[model samples]
Target: MTIEQSPAPSDVADVYDGIGQIYGSAWGPNYHYGYWDDADDTSSIEVATDRLTDMMISGLDVRPGQRVLDVGCGIGHPALRLVRTGDVDVVGISVSHVQVAQANELAAAAGLAEKAKFQFTDAMDMPFPDGSFDAAWAFESMWHMPDRGQVLSEIARVLRPGGHLAIVDVIERGPVSPEGRKVLDHVCENYAVKSLGTVDEYRTALAANGFVDVEIRDISDNCNRTLAVMADAVETKYDELAALVGEEQATSLLAFMRLSAVTPEQGYLYLAAVRA
Candidate 1:
């Protein structure tokens, strides 16, 4: 199978630097999906996103003093929450300097600077040493990677034996209709996403890299709400978004929100595995 490379780092950084501001204003701090317990649950998007983060944290089985790595950490919200909830220190890495700066500022402002630190680093070539982390996670950030296997290899290398890894990402579920593919490609264009990974790809990659006890499951039902919510937010702030990312790119994003809202082929998946 041929996995594609990610967009250029500069391109990816530009994409996030603009969208991050929009996301911060619209969807609170977290840029990932929202979770709902069931049809009756009506938690706000901010709370739902945190719930998803907590869900990922729950699977890590981390200890208080262990270090955790946050791959493609957008703004360090999850890292900060992890330190508060589990008393673990986090070292978050992102390609975007804007994000690293903002995340560090947030961590400092929250008095968690020593516990959660963000840096501008590429996951494909992590600066961390072998066995540097006790646990790791990528929250909806894997798709931006140019080389999925390289990033996973780095994750595996940095994590100590018996350390747990968790990942939550959007994926191509299966057999996307041509029309759906068209929308998916358009979303990729504006979002700086090269390609989405499949569940089987993850399973194979994890096993090949000496990970064990891998478990992956679908969580789309809980996350699909994020698209519509984001669309609503973009619409309400279209002028502001246009100012940040220009009217053209901002319009494409809004259209993606509408199109991808009904695109069932785009699904969310969660995977947890232990490093061996």
Candidate 2:
């Protein structure tokens, strides 16, 4: 396979727009849920994502009447889930127009038309006022962001004082060898991820941006297992995905899945974090 270079915003946008189209259909609804146990069974997408969403929500401690923002909300699944609490107003933002449209449709269907909505916008340039939200969450999407610090800064800017931010994503870890880096770079290049930082890197950024009470949780096992199961699922639906997104994209996605299985199996990593 030919390896590509680091992705631009437009490049990432195209990849995710396609992902948004087949996200629920191919991934089975957990929308790339993180893993706690590499061996945990992910046969059931509903169960896997449910556990993942619960874990994420628990960290945010979202309450009724709170204003929440979901940065990089894919199809607004988590935002929809958050509205079930009956006390939160949620706005999901995505760079992909397709995802925003789909998410809005899903939100409307779930009867959360007023409380939860998705818009097509960049996280680094969100069109919201300062102190606009009580909490912000980024589930498995920050890694895909090219400028995470800027995104974090924007998040900090929009959050109310002492507002919470919860993120569940893959983080790079110690002593990455040349080979390991190559594997990671290959996956990132093919899939259009600009960069993925370590857990400490994130803490430093959060602190630099004036965030406190930062917590990083090791969920590599969960990520690994999810990737493994998802690989199988993708393979099972390879034909359909190719039909929807073409062969090159489908192959690239499989390469992404195969790489995730390798990273955590070889090193320790944090898959999630919550900060105030």
Candidate 3:
């Protein structure tokens, strides 16, 4: 599936440009789910998300000075963490111009301007040349892309032979019941996601794209707390969110978050594959 070079869907851009700051304030810099080691763990969202980031980085096994690409990098926090932890140079890309600008500014302020750079680019049609990166990671970003296969293909194309790709994304476990589908639909619509694919689908796409050593680990239980935390954050900032994005949007967003937290059929997964 080839995605045209036209601008991304307005929902994708608008969601970020409009309430990105507010969302970031609630969701933290990772903008993704957290991985808890223990079921009873009561860590902050930032700490838990950092744990998830560290897991992805470990899977990538990057080295100093190696170039890494961050697909759908929001606010560049995870990319900056990679620079500090692995001494890797990172190029982060996002469809949201607001995020791109903010990410670059954050990188500069953190004294990582040379090490971590961000650009307004799409995952389905990245701007970089083939074999440009040693490693790449998409943290909960693939669901928003119009075509997961095309996005994975692009990731494979930009990665050097033997380069690794690590991803943490929401996945559909199986055919959902009618009630489950309703909740799934609401989450997708509000989140600007096209659809959630299955674990087997992801494995097949990776293999078809010339990626090897594919490993998928279901970490849904560990990551499910992210939605719960987000729901609480929304409630805590209910009026502020309503003021920022209007009452209807805020209400819908909160409902989506709360419902998604309890929906068991929709889950999360961590996948790692190597460009062959």
Indicate the worst ten consecutive residues by lDDT in candidate 1. 1-10
Q: What TM-score should be assigned to candidate 3?
A: 0.94
Predicted structure with the largest TM-score when compared to the true one: 1
Q: What is the lDDT for 199 in model 3?
A: 93
Q: What is the lDDT of residue 162 in candidate 3?
A: 97
Question: Which wins on lDDT, candidate 2 or candidate 3?
Answer: 3
Candidate 2 TM-score, true structure as reference: 0.87
Q: List the residue pairs that clash in candidate 3.
A: none
**Higher-ranked by lDDT: 1 or 2:** 1
Off by over 4 Å in 1: 1-5, 245-248
Q: Estimate each model's TM-score.
A: 0.95, 0.87, 0.94
lDDT of 3 by residue, 1-276 (tens): 122332355678887776656777777778888889878898888899999999999999999999999999999999999999999999999888888998999999999999999998878887799999999999988888888899999999999999999999998876687877887777676667778878988988998899999999999889987888888875777788899879998888888777877888789999998999
C-alpha lDDT score of every prediction, in listed order: 0.87, 0.73, 0.86
- As a TM-score, model 1 comes out at 0.95
